[model samples]
Target chain A: MSEIHALSAGLALDASVIGGKAHGLVALMRLGLPVPPGFVIPTAACRVFLETGGLPGGELAGAVRELEAVTGRRFGDPARPLLVSVRSGAAVSMPGMMDTLLNVSSTGDLRAAVREVFASWTAPRAVTYRELHDIPHDQGTAVVVQAMVLGDRDDHSGSGVAFSRDPSTGERRPYGDVLFRSQGDAVVSGTVPTLPLDALATREPAVWVGLMDALDRVERHFRDVCHVEFTVESGRLWLLQVRPGGLSGRAAVRVAVDLVDEGLIDRATAVRRITPGHLRAAAVPRIRAAAPPLPSPDPASQDSATWDRAGSGSAMQAFPGSDPPSTGSSRPVTEVGSAASSGLEILARGRGAGPGVATGRVAVTADGAVRMAAAGPVILVRPHTSPLDLHGLAAAAGIVTTTGGLTSHAAVVARSMGKPAVVGATGLTVRTHDVVVNGRSIPDGAAADADADADADHMATDGHSTSEGTTGNDQTATDGRSTPEGTTGNNQTATDGRTTLGITATDTDQVVMDGWSIPEGTVITIDGTGGEIVLGVAETAAGDTGPHVDRLLRWAAEESVA
Target chain B: MTDLTVLHTLRCMGFTDLGRVASAAGLAPEEAESRLIDLAVEGLVTRVPGAFGGWGLTEAGKAEDARLAAEELDKAGARAAVTSAYTDFMVLNPELLDLSTAWHLRTVDGVAAVNDHTDAAYDARVLARFADLDRRVSPVCAALTAALPRFGSYRRRLSAALARGDLAETTESYHNVWFQLHEDLLVTLGIPR
Candidate 1:
């Protein structure tokens, strides 16, 4: 059998042979999506090269000749040279573990690039990744040699990765980041800030429409949420890669249920797709709108309003403005609370680096965090964290950074400590003794004094601010919320001045929004699951599966009974 | 000449105790304390009086350390070598961070959970990768050491951290030492953080 196979609809090879990337390209071609013409050197060829340290003599040359004939361009010709990108595609994804060479226009360079990619499979980092992920080492990666589509070809050109749905919220909206007049590498490098994918719609409407159509078709074919990497050359859209099913937790559950409603999948498939881990992740306490005094007559309209309110909290919120939920049949799985209804204002929003909800007083410095933690839970806020902040991070209940992304040092450490973290709050400013968020300069140390006063006052009134009382309240809240009679139990708990979970009357009384400065001991709630930072303790529904999860679980039970 | 070794070490390590400064600078705790006191008299460093506080550089100490680092580099005529090494270090830096993150969080059933270090095989796999990365970083370390002798301590400190299984979380962990080295490179090159 030939070692090289043309990437086409008719290519009949297992992913284990051609690698997942090439197989996806084959699927794209089969679906009639525009993909750059390419030939794949299967894993067999890579194995042979690894053993012999040389390419098979005439096979590569012959493939290149066929490619040249098809494209009407020569490999090394100066005018209109056939530039190509050589990429590594393993059966199991080992992201960022191998190398890719782009813009290769010469035979010699192509050969050398192929060799480097093959050798990279055995690179120490890649090997370690494989071992950690339990991917077999002996199965080599296929080399995908594709005709390069220049994203930098003109002012109308660009590259980006688009998700069929919002990966974070699992809202059925096309979402992603795009870089104009730059290659795909720049988008992934994150050195340059990217425009939201919707920008492509206004700038290159034709490409945008084509991309939207392609996304819809791929989602239908895969029967799940799909992500595509694409480049538009002078306004023509060409998909470079396609991947399905990377959504997790709440997003995954939402997508599964939505897919069932769309008739692309059945109830059984939807229930089967959601694992127990997804349920646990979905149950992680999220910042939701406090239950409305009266349920809205129309839940669907209320759902959209809730989405707008929740999205408005983030400066980088990338929802499709003015678009209703994609599926009318799908209900809101997680209802977010509005500021007016919840009686809590969002101070700032960021990327959720860790998962869970934490309520604490703000501590601007690491030292302050340690000192304040002796009295109450503290949230360590920083411009960016370093090794020096390790102790502060350890001591804090949660972490917030004014700068840095999800993978920053602060984020990594916070996750290690199992603390909820929010990073990349661009509107936040860290001063010497305080933090400024959304034009409000909050004093750090003054809150500590205020908390002491509140404690003294609380002792005089109810004696519930003590450590033992707080623990008892927490235990009652946890047990109450787990019972079928949770709503009544929670209402009763809230009626008592000091028995609400993570909140006390003294805490709420001090939550006054005075001219700019929120004292250091003023309570705030952060939802690391949704990246929402709310002033004062916001109500959290820890185990509420919501309407979507409830409907899916019901279907699962019915399917089992049948 | 004032021995700026202890001062620079403190600058790179951030606010740390005398014991950490001594261990990182390859000096005895008493010797490190003596130098810190001398620097404190000059208002280059200060000791915060609290449970969380320790010996740390003041603004003056930070400026002095930067100046001294620049002068040391020029005197050794090692700026070019150090810069080249820094370039190489940047390539490995992300990979190291990725490894550290992998050590802390592992995906189970597609949800990332804190690694409890219960899975012995998984821990062994991650540790083996750290060892592999350490091997690859040796050349970069050698190049930096050739440029400045103080950099030789990093090679020893990193290996010791790995040997002690202090991959992350701890003050003396491999990740912490690597972070200091990154800061040292930026300071030595007179680059902004």
Candidate 2:
């Protein structure tokens, strides 16, 4: 049997044979979308290569000849070279754990790239990801070789990933990041800041319109919210990939309901789509400010002392009673409203990997975290975590990494420990003794000793003895009873109460540097449910699913009655 | 050079107790303690006194360990071989971490809940995968041992952890041992963690 198959509308094969990516490309072709022309080397070919460690030499050369003819350019012909991207695509999506080589022009390099992509299926990270996700070990990945559509071809060129609806909030709007005059890899790496997807509308209007149309058509075709990776080569749009339905939790529910409202899917289908896991995740407590921003607290009256006292009082009142049993649907809005009134300014945002709320001081290193934990609760902030940081993870009240998604090691460990974690906060940078968030540098340890001492003096005048003014020393007093006034009485579980109070009491350092820098000892509350990192302590309210979930469930009930 | 076995072992294991440092170094606790005391007197290591405290390398100890590790690699003429083995080790590193994380957390009903180890079948599946990974990693360990004999201790400790079913959580678990081996590779290759 032939090991190669052209990725076209007429190609009919199971994902097991062609791999999910090839299958999706064929689907996009079938929908009349502008998918870059490509061909797939089936998984069986990879299996053979794995067994014999040799490519089907004649067949690969013949396939290249056919691709050259189709693209009207010769391979390795520098005058009009036909470069292709060689990518790994298993039946299952093992995102970011496999290899992909781009801009290969020579036949030898192309063959080598294809071999590498096939071999990446068993790459240790890929193997572990498969093992964790229950993907079969023996099902080797297929190789997809597509003619390159260079996003860096011109000023009008760009690459981006777009969701048909907002992946975070499930709003019916295109949401994604775009990098102009760069390849898709640059966009995915998060090394360079990207403009909003709307930037394409102004710069390359035709490509933007085409992308929107493609998104609409795919959503209709799949009957679900879709994510697409697209590239514009000199203003001509080419879709590199498309996948349906990876929206999770609240976003998933919102998309399902929105789809029903749009007549793309029925209510029964919407009900069937959301699982118990989605319901559970949707019910996790989120900071009230994560939704539409509450009116900013009046800056003129926002004195640190007054704000702390007011915030403390409101937090206690926010959770006056035991948490109401979660029903996976609506909750009383009054609780959320009361918590939202605290008016905490958000420092940064990222994907919520763990569920709950945690407030603590930031520690840039694991050892720093361990040292800081003795004085008060600490949040271990790192560029990324390794096994070496395990101890720091253990000692921290919560965790934050400037990079990595929910499936990253730091996120997994945070969830394992039941600690609130925010990951992929790309705007944050970790340094040796400090962290820079956005443009503000927040010093830690010895760098912040001067500020801590000054804050201690400020606290003394207020008659609060929470600050020891000796943050530089390892022998900072651990007296829990000296908790700062108006920082206690929150309904945090008894197990967390001591650390929570300790963190709040010790975070007496006033924000310096034009109220931009939040020093190491400064208090910050993180909402793992909503991915919000807020300055100061903010009360968490159980994620209010708004009306979409209630409406979807109501439809399900009606469908069952019928 | 003075024997840096216990010191190097402690350096890789991060902060840990004497028992674990001894076990990883393939020495008795008393022998490890003697070495540790000797090293501490030189201001290379320190014993932290607290609930979370243990014996850890001081800044000077870490620098000394790195210098010694590089010296050992060069003296043995195993830099190229060890570097190649380190490359192979990195491929298995992520899988080990994934397994460790899986042992600690499982997705039930789509939410990441703590594994709790109640579901025997789930635990068995994870353990089986660990064993499978261990089998695959044997060659990499073998390559490393051939390059440097001290690397053999990792192979022994990893198998022991698997045999004892201490996959994660414990200080002597397979995850911890694997983690130390990763650190050793970086230290030997002069690669930054």
Best of the candidates, DockQ? 2
Residues A335-366, model 1: lDDT tens digits: 11225555556665666667778988776666
Name the top lDDT candidate: 1
Tens digits of per-residue lDDT for model 2 on A1-562? 3478878899999999999889889999999989887789999988988888877678788888898989998887878899999998888777767889998988899889988987887676677666666778998989899999998998888887777875555667776656678888764643233455777888888888999999899999999977778889998999888878755566677778878877888888999998777776666666654344333232112111101000010000111010110100001122223334555555555656576789887766666576667877878777777655666788899987766555566776687677888776544544333343442222222213322333223212111223333332211124442222223322232112222111112243322221122334456677665566666666665645556666767888898899
Fnat value of model 1? 0.35
Q: What is candidate 2's DockQ?
A: 0.27
TM-score of chain A of 2: 0.72
DockQ for all candidate structures vs. native: 0.21, 0.27
lDDT for B181 (candidate 1): 97
lDDT of 1 at A421: 88
